[model samples]
Target: MAKGLLCSAMQMTWRWFSPDRTVTPRRQLRFPAYTPNAVSLALKSISKKTKCLPFGLRQPDRPLLLGGHSLDIVHCHQYLGVWFDSRLTFATHVHYIRERAATRIAALKALSHSNLGALYSVLQTFYSYAIHSIVDYRAVCLVEVLESLRLSLEVLQNTVLRVMLGAPPWMRLVNLRAESGFPSLQHRIWERTTAVIAQLCRHWPRFTVSVLLQRTLDRPPNPHPGGDWILLAADIVRKLDATNAICGGPDLPDPAYAPAPPWLPPLIRCVEPTTAVPRSSFPAVLCQDSLSHVAALSTPDAAVYYTDGSVSDDGSAGAAFVCDEWVESWRVTSSVSDYQTELVAILGTLRHADRHFYRCIIIHTDSLSSVCGLQTQRYTDNKYLTAIIAVAASITGQGGEVILHWLPGHVGIAGNERAEADARHAATFPVPTFQLHPSLSLLLRRVAYTVRHLSWEDHQFQIYEGSRSATWYAIETAYAPVTVPHGTSNYLLVSLRHLRLGFPCCGQMTNSNPEPCPHCFDISEQPLLHYVLDCPATSRLRCGISEQLHNRDEPFIWQQRLLHRHLPL
Candidate 1:
């Protein structure tokens, strides 16, 4: 009877699993078997290429034969780059990642050598792509790893940072991380784990993992010997105050996998050049002239619809469409970004046009991103873009036409202004919910933003408060837009960073009893500040700078000058 049941199960598996002849048992296979009898039966009918790994605490007492050959019992196996041992501890996988990351760190050190002349940004990029990627691969599985193993990964990150910055070994890890703008591995893993949880929550019922997570949350707490990723993720969500943010509603659609249908009518786009002069910079008269030109180009009999989307300060999103027939507005989930809101607005316009069978529909929107996305017809993983294409194709396939016009927003256009106002109004007041799912990209972005702010706060209290860097911290608020410009030489970039961090190698900073300035004999205690502002050695150069400032009639603030605010000149 057991043999009959086994044969029946194998037949069913072959029939359903390989119905299309795409998968066959003849292919290379390795499976973990829970029982010795099952392993024996599986090996007898399988190809010699197959390998069986017996699981559970009990070992097979006797050797099992398959075609007169004894089967080999395996203790470890690799699948999808992750090693799984009989104990399921993931220690082997972590060790493998450490070794691989160490090799990549060596490569980074070679490239960042002084003779190679690689820029800080280039080294950072290599670290992110080569070293960090290897460490971050499948990090969600490492949540339950030993604390020692996790710290080993962080040590590798510190080594990479030191190589990139060429900082002394005495430098603090917090300062090095802040200087390089890289978060700690722990924070990164938390961010990644939270992002995955958000995605699973956002697409509940679609993924099996999501279903299991939901079940785990609903059940009474039980001891999990192997550690529970779902429970860990839930704890993180609560700590982040994102419990409400990740709750999935019943109305969200499953992601569309099929390609967009072809449209019969050509999509007409009147998009302005991306590099055109800024509308904000245009004079009032020019703005009016441009608006008039846009008004004149509208087809007399065609339906002209204006669309706009708004995002409030608190992250609530709203989209609205205005036309001669009606003005409609609705709010969407706060997790949707302003860009996706714009796409939703345009999508609404197309849906309306298709419903009423309008012959020619012209949509005026302020979102250049939406227009460009439609123009390119390359919707890569964006479910909204895919749906928009599908709807537009449906409209055009039925002999109707859709035209998209990109217009500068808030330029006193009547319909556009009404749409924008309605969108903002919808965002302010409770309106009909749009029933759109939270975007995965936007959710991940929120996680990243929260992690960055948390890291910054930690840095402020731990590193900035008790260090010599406090001097720069006091004055940092004075410089509103202090940023290192792209393409700066590595030497200048490093110098500026050191100065901002209050560790410049000046005599006063480096010595307890500093001597007078060697070049100008200045006796000021703050030698770096005096050297830039009052040194007679640089009098001729200062004269040229003062003349330029005088010509521009701007005040000569020594702080701003020292901060490289005038470097653009």
Candidate 2:
């Protein structure tokens, strides 16, 4: 299963690899260009940079247009125009065009007519429309010049909207004759669009087109029936074209897939449609390349880090253990913040626990909430907490044990100090514009990609280990019960009885409301069985530990028996 997964990932990744670019499972090499999916992935990842910036423009470092031949470029240009025209429904086009005109008028009337800002704004709008039309719509050719003209409103709107809505206020008013004269300029723009529509009506065979368009531009009704009218027009067009095709006349293909240029190189001819439906069996590109998911698994052991969440008077806090480095990292944020915020960052790191060096798992944190939350059988309440729990399950499902420990915040521990600095820096810094470590970024991409394709049930289980040097298990045993020696512990014990006496057991009301157990049950005053056989939290904690041990094919019943025997019976 591991090998299959790794292979599938590599294959899918390689499909984006052009003839000149290749990825080897064994060695590191950079591809000159990114795949469409890679670009999409990059766009999605931009959220990690900062929330302030708009994510749409977060493009790949290299341009997608690079490396294609002139013919490929020409075809691409044509395809783009068709795509844009087809993708925007008629009503969308009308709405967008109308909106564009309004914005354009607003920008033009913001300042005096002859100002540099006015001229620049107008020219930029036209330039953007022209370029976008050519590159995306391939609408430059004049076989049906009227069709391109039909798209004029959409083009104009896109340009003006960006300038008017997206730019600074000063810039928006750059060409305005006077601030108060703005409404007049907008009125003039409406007149201009109306005149254009008049021209289309004069030449076009379709009278309904004019009426429908006038409905959009003239503001026919309160709800703006332009969109529905435009859809009606499109339906008419499609029906007319279908009738023509049935009559053995020139068969007009549906407009959605934009027809390619009538004249192109023979090589650019459309391939025959596939006879069989395309199955998503491992992409062929993935099968051809070799990548081993298990290879990384076999590499010299790396230390596992376990971080837990906490809340205190000072702020939200977290503790982490770096197994290989034998360091504990912990932090305390301002108490006002939510626990889940800190948990996201910590859980993100823990999910990738095997990436670091050393064979040990060291936990450093004062977050009893996080530790208890993971150990307990209660359903997580917070959305972020639930996500973290799912990820923890995925990690431990692979026979890995996360050793959670508590550390006093502000006590000046080195790892905790570093973590605090990192956390504070993360809070203050804007989302990164770009990741410095591309390799790590790529690894993250692979994991994310895998997650998307694989269901939660089929997710890979990664085993977590502690430090490799100097009898790490032996060192761990010093702090653990004697039944488990020089190995990962197989039982979880907590002071839950004092925390909630009957909350996990009876679900009964009490005279005084104690703080509810963060792990289990909803009520604060309910008595809980924290001692031996009955406590839900304890039972859950025991089950989780036993499952981990059983996954490793180790005898955990003995450990459970020991814990049961040790309980105050």
Candidate 3:
């Protein structure tokens, strides 16, 4: 499974390795006259001295000669537009990306301090569309490489948004990301990988499949053991196989051996053109915390059942059961999510505990939630949780005892890999009936999420429709739309709004009704416009405001319009 998963991941990586997209010096590498041109025209034309960058596994302190010219390799370099280090750890890459992104953010800060018209909006566009693309490019590969680097990328994005909103740097980042419509760095990476995987599964691109197949055909004994991607690729191949189950001899799969998930949502919505039907068993990618599963599985006389659940792009589900020598799988309905299916597979595995007579059986799952659910029983209110509890109750009636273990998916554990493969295979099975009965709480939460998203979008639309200033548009992109300017002016704007709505001014909201403008001690009602634009005490600031509009002699009507338009009170 590890071998296969590795091949699959390599395929994906290679597909993205488009030659045209690379920013390396490779285009000139193959040039016939490259060496002489570099010593002559290239060096003479350059203002700064040229440097050399090397990649790959072989490391040497000595420089390499290119047409008799020695090129020295330093510690870090950029390749294919992403940075790399001598160790290929991507640490340098992350640092380069961060520094470059920070420069843009600092530019934005400078722009804001300058108080240029519509500059905030410009910054917003730069961050939202352009900068994000720059930082997120090929992040799918880099994200899985290091957690710290992933967080760094996220922090960079947050810093950009925080600057635009004039928000405190110490603001809760999670809440801030959520409010600003930015998913966490990790989530964005996950989402992208998931989409790519789904596309790969759906299309089964010829080039990727052919290349991977050719590589696996060699299958040398004691092959180079790398990471879990090999196992993941193996699982994928097995699941896609039409006959000759990867593990179960050379015979075709047996339909009678298959089983379904113990529970599913009561209400299922059917979709047309479902996922591809399963041809063979499959498993999932390796997960984090795989070592625990490895350590626990080392016990003797304990049979490991790698069970997994999968949901396809169209929302169809499949559950797989992989015991020693036997592989069972079945397609399920939509309504149930990938996470729910994983938990449901665990429940099914638990119920099957009575069938297997092993003295100690290990039910291994890649789903973190399922493991947590079994331990905490937090999902008791949900139907799936109830189903899990019911199965768990019957466990005592069976053999010695079944231990539920959380095995990180895709790490290439034999049993776990088989289960994940089978589950994914089941997901592709074409089914006519799709039934689901979602628990009320589960249904409500999904609905609420959708509603909240729509409401936020609608609110944004209203703000856009009501205002024309680019600055407001940009700031509101990260914050709730507000007509008031940021800084101290926001306070004044909010207070003014309250006063207009029949609420007393800031000092004390007593029966004294509306208080006079405290700043100017005016006898007239403390209208915000008078205090902000026409008050004698504020005459100096008013002149500055007039100068901003390009002339101190501008009419009072212009000042009123500026306040009314921008302040919107």
Candidate 4:
């Protein structure tokens, strides 16, 4: 009866809003269970299973009237590309994703041919943007779904990885992921979900989703059998140990007002080195000359201030501004990035200028990022930057002029040197807090650190469990620091990866029938090693390559040679 009244009210509301438009009953879905009585006409084509009643309750057969039309109920529906069912199991969605991913995986397979298809790197890029994007979309909402659903997604990822690498089904999943540098689907989902939760925590007041999340978290714990996304997110955060890293508090106001328009007279001036200034000039001399040039260019009455920001080895951040009349320094949260600290220094200078009603203010900073950010209006994304722009706009509105001068750092300009020292001191010894909220960059860094730590732990466990061979582990450890140089051919990368994994290209590692080396019929066992190092067929090439090595006297280890590690002198 309640559902009937709700339908009637919706019908009346729809007609009142749009008289010409009619409600489409066929598109609607009813949760938990559907009933035949809900429909006006007896539609024989409608399945009886869809209308199965809950708790064995039955009512007199009646039609659900909507805008003077009968409405039909559905057991499942698709909204925004995600399938939803009465039970909210997400099984339908997972199945759909697997089918969709299989289609793309087939396309990838078509491009995996050795000579006729696209490069491995190209295929990987396509997977990241095309296939992975589909699977990762709205994955945060699926955090609490059944383990089977999660495993299905994992299986989909594993299949894609196998197709991309052309790895045999016998290859272990851990080795496959390590070789490809792709984390497990579950880890990826957790990372993505944690990132979203961090963002929501930071901007809780700004977005509707954040507001809803905040409300949900504020209420008493109400356990749901299927589990709750918000609770799962909170648990993930706790596990990451990033509760303190979660940024909270309102964002700064937009600084796009007329007084601070992007077209406003050149406020930020970068000091470009000229041809007259020889590159071989002493650092101190160069800084002195630059300072003199800036002073000459500035207004005679303008108050010149030097601002600098610093980050200690321990990650504490500090910012300071030094002027003739007064000097101020602040110790910001360690999570605040060096770039943000630089902006904070500039912001302090602006606030000081505004407070003292300086007619002309010139702020000299060595941070080009901060200067560029101001010029490009990138301050909209950061609180300190936004505050800087706001204060600068206020100064400009009151018939005052503000200018920023970019100069080289650690070059010994007196005021800049003093500011730098004060910033260092502030960073070393905690001063008053400037801002407590962590910078977005720092939050992202923390999240990446947590994800990497977790991944490393998992990798170690895999190694301890004997999932990877010692030779494979040694190769991975050696090549961990090494990266493929730019412009490397796709064929070379694939060959190198195969070499690292000890893939049975030579058939010696195969369990069944092993084949002898084509070049050397005598060398049947360990054909890969013999082909690379012992084969007389490639002896001339090997000798030629050996002469180019730093130490030709030392024998080239297979691990070093195959992984392409630089030979020690």
Runs in model 2 deviating more than 4 A are 1-338, 354-360, 432-569
Q: Which candidate is the best by lDDT?
A: 4
Residue-level lDDT tens digits of model 3 in 52-151: 4433323433443433544444556444676656445688777877877777777777755423423445556767665777755765456335667777
lDDT of 1 by residue, 1-569 (tens): 00000111122211113223222234333333324676677733442443334333335455544345454545655656776565566788888988888888888877776544687878989988988887677778777778898888888888888888777665666667766778888888888777777766665556877776666556554555346667776666655555555665322332532454467333545555444455556656445765765676677768889999999888788999999859988887675788889988988888888888888888888898787777664565456777777777677668777778887776677888899999988887665488666566766777787777776776677644576454343354222323555655556655555554455444644677667887787678777656655777655546657654333233224324544543211
Candidate closest to the true structure, highest TM-score: 4
TM-score of each: 0.74, 0.20, 0.34, 0.75
lDDT of 2 by residue, 1-569 (tens): 01100011122211223232211122232232244676766622221211111111222233222123111101111121131232233333334435545654564446313222333334445534643233222222211223454556444534443343332222222112111112222222322232233334333425666556434333323343243434433233232222111111111211222222336221111112122423233444222211121122233443434343333444334333333344333343332233443454455565556444223333445454545554433332233345555544444446554444443344444454565555544443333321111111222233333333322111111102221211222222211222322222112122211111111223333334455555563444333322333355456546546554334333334344534544332
Q: How many residue pairs collide in each prediction?
A: 0, 47, 35, 0
Candidate with more favorable, higher lDDT: 2 or 4: 4
- Write down the lDDT of every candidate, Cα atoms only: 0.66, 0.33, 0.50, 0.66
* Candidate 4 lDDT for residue 373: 77
Give, for candidate 2, the lowest lDDT window spanning 10 residues: 1-10
Better of 1 and 4 by lDDT: 4
Q: How well does model 3 score by local distance difference test?
A: 0.50
Shift of residue 435 alpha carbon in model 2, Å:
17
Write model 4 residue lDDT over 118-218, tens digit each, in one string. Answer: 77777889899879998678677578779988988888888888888877786667666766777888878887887787676665566766665566555
